[model samples]
Target: MNASPSHQPHPAEWTETQSLLPCVERDLPAGRHQFHKEQLMARIHEDLRTTTRPEPPKRRPNPFLRRTVLLPAAALALAGAVAGGFALSSGDPHGGRTALATGPALTTTVGAADAEGAPRLLDRISLAAADTSTPTPRKGQYIYIESKVASTYTSSVGDKTSVVSEELHPRQVWNSLDGKDGWLIEPGQTGDEGITLASEVVMSGAYDVLATLPTDPDALLRRIYRESDATRDHEVPRDQAAFTAIGDLLTESYPPADVSAALYKAAAKIPGVVAVDDAVDATGRHGVAIAREDGTGERTEWIFDKKTLRFLGERVVVVKAVAGSPFKVGTVVFTSAITQRAVVDANKQVPGGAS
Candidate 1:
């Protein structure tokens, strides 16, 4: 792992007098320069809030439940469906059966087909539709959700064996676009309890909220791109200096190779996954490549379970920079492991009006 940069004191560091005083007052051109610098800093700070991504709502783990175990029958059914060409759900927890049905009509401009010959386009459409139909449990709504998570991490510097179990609670709801009518609820709590050699620790923290798209793969990609852009534009700048500092630190710590390897390892485990591809976006930024991993490894493609129209859980990777390093060190193998609770209202209007 890459270490943080040393905090060596520089002999030429600016003193308070030199940095704070107006240079023009002393009959020098530096005073005018100082004024301009101040103005620039002020503008940056002012624009930061508007430009930053919206902070995801607060989610707390549910405390009432301890461990949520998937019934053997359900597990086997899900595994079989994923291995085959279809997708499956455990259905509603309230004893109601909501079968996995065909997703809404949508189209995609990107992605390739997977190994089993399932059209990635259809998968995206399915996801978009599910996203639209799924309702997140809100403050007053009756929603049902079930999750299973497995997480492993090294202990903080002084501690040995890190483990925890937590129950997540729902906090807020956001509407999904892509033509499916439903809302996405950001769960506040984590469901998995961390286990270590000595003791089990309940890990409780906010998880990232993602917009589910209807089954159309292209539609799903569009929503993902849009949400990511919104996050970068609105949420990142709220704490501009802090985010910038973290970016700088990451650049100085790890090598590019290490970061790439970590990402590949995480991507390999997603179900129905075939390969990982890479590309440059329209703006020339380096973009991610997630393709179907065929036997030859030459064919580029995207992974999706055609039956349920849901992206395989393993394919969704969360990349976070390792603190003080230029490398990405940590990896979480599962995506659906994060708690997702949905509320179905036969009477309420769609959560948010379509854009």
Candidate 2:
């Protein structure tokens, strides 16, 4: 009965049957038949009038991205702070002190006792000791005297030995005894031969000779002392000729004020001078007034022996130059030979001579 029905199937059934056949064949070749099956399925779908489904909207990343980035940044900042704190807390290898917030205060004190009384006493003692120790000729007095100078001199002519002897009269203005009024014998005119020449010389040639009558030796001595004191204070050139004349008569005298001051200044500049004592040259004793200069020559100090107040001596230490060279070339020692004897009578004026 089914075979009889199949011989005369309906048109609809036939079409369905044909569709089923093609689908079976497509199933056998899925890679090649997918497009055709899809076309047919699209046609069926179009015929069915199905509603279209809307697509979901695209989404963006979370808004917390800024916070995410800042988290790591914050971590890095904390790490840097920790490291910096460690560095500051650690002690420095070098010996550097911590900075101070404020500076220290300064203070000073003054008194009349220091400025007037004590200083004066000390000065008096110093002066007295100096006067007694050195043979300084009385000031302002004229004297006839002789000196034996021991010196080695080299001249263009050659080396020679010289003996200098003369009669010296100190004048307020005259510094040397070699001039016309000064008493120095010319070469070959010394001894008895110079007696006639000495007589012929005029007293007018004398320099700084005072014309005061009834010679006041004290006044003359005072004038000399005052001049010498002024010279010492003001730093005037030590008139060598004047000093020599005075020294010849008195034995020793202070260098001019200027020279003494210069020596002080120089001593101060020396690197190692710790103290300076006054110069001294009198009574056959010779030494500087000030004993300064440290042994090492790097620092200096001013020194005065409280008891003696006289400069005894200085100890100098060696110092090397920047280039490691020797700094000092030589050492100089200054000595003096002065006496405390009056060589001439204060009231005795030279015959036919102006005071």
Candidate 3:
């Protein structure tokens, strides 16, 4: 298990937010910016194709390389901090309920039934997004998101026995549209800090970058695939990596209505995409989903409101059972629901209420 991250004071006060919120900072793991940049550049170069000279590659520094080794560890920590509900061999065969050491725990509800296959659904979602009027904020504004997440893991007591554990938590994040400032708030921890915008990773949580993305579905899809390849760890499968890249963009950033619709259309073009109706988010809101199963027994779904066609959340489920795995077939390994999102003028200003 990874140790919890600690909160550190800002080296210097932020003049922009000193009046509204205190500048408490978090220690970002090194190389995070580099990793994001690599992903971004992949997409841009794929489109431009202007460079003929094979420039020397930029290698990660030794200190940052060591930090890169901790990426998986940090993932585990984030998983425990945000995810919840594990599966057991003894639980319901459908895996909606989990069997705890003490008793059976009623957990996630079963996913919704399949809808009009992937193609039709994606088309409708794209049309809806294009028709809707979600606001596009200015560069200095902030986007606030309130959400809940759950993660599942397995722990072995001995070679023969193990237990699956899951934890769920709520989170609030304020992102600067220009990508110069941000803040994260969760149970018992908060961070106020500075961050750089990666021009390459257009889908990353940077509104400025997202604004610059191509509006055409084909062009956008190509960019996403290229970027996914550029920053991928190589351990993940290609299709899965591409799908995850899209998911990250949808979940973490607020894109313009046109761009969002273009992305939906682009996603529909991806092979192996599927649709599910009646999926439930962590908040218990029922919606539809577009999903893809990674070759590794895990399936990721992006859930959306049925009527409004608005994004609701995302979930990860187990499609196959593996020995000693924390997740069983049909088990919901992770879920996150976006409760609220709005554009505000100040870092401390929330959309519907006080920060």
TM-score of each: 0.25, 0.23, 0.65
Clash number for each model: 66, 48, 8
lDDT of 1 by residue, 104-127 (tens): 111113333343333343333323
lDDT of each: 0.21, 0.20, 0.48
Candidate 1 lDDT for residue 73? 13
Best-fitting candidate, measured by TM-score? 3
Instruction: Pick the lDDT winner.
Output: 3
lDDT of 1 at 57: 19
Tell me how candidate 2 scores on lDDT: 0.20
The 10-residue segment with the lowest total lDDT in model 1:
1-10
Summarize candidate 3's per-residue lDDT along 148-252 as a digit string, tens digits.
554443333446443232344555556667543555444312112211112111124356766777899999888877765655666666666666556555555
> lDDT-based ranking, best first?
3, 1, 2
- Over 4 Å off, model 2: 1-126, 129-141, 144-288, 291-335, 346-355
Candidate 3 lDDT for residue 89:
20
Return the TM-score for candidate 3, rounded to 2 decimals.
0.65
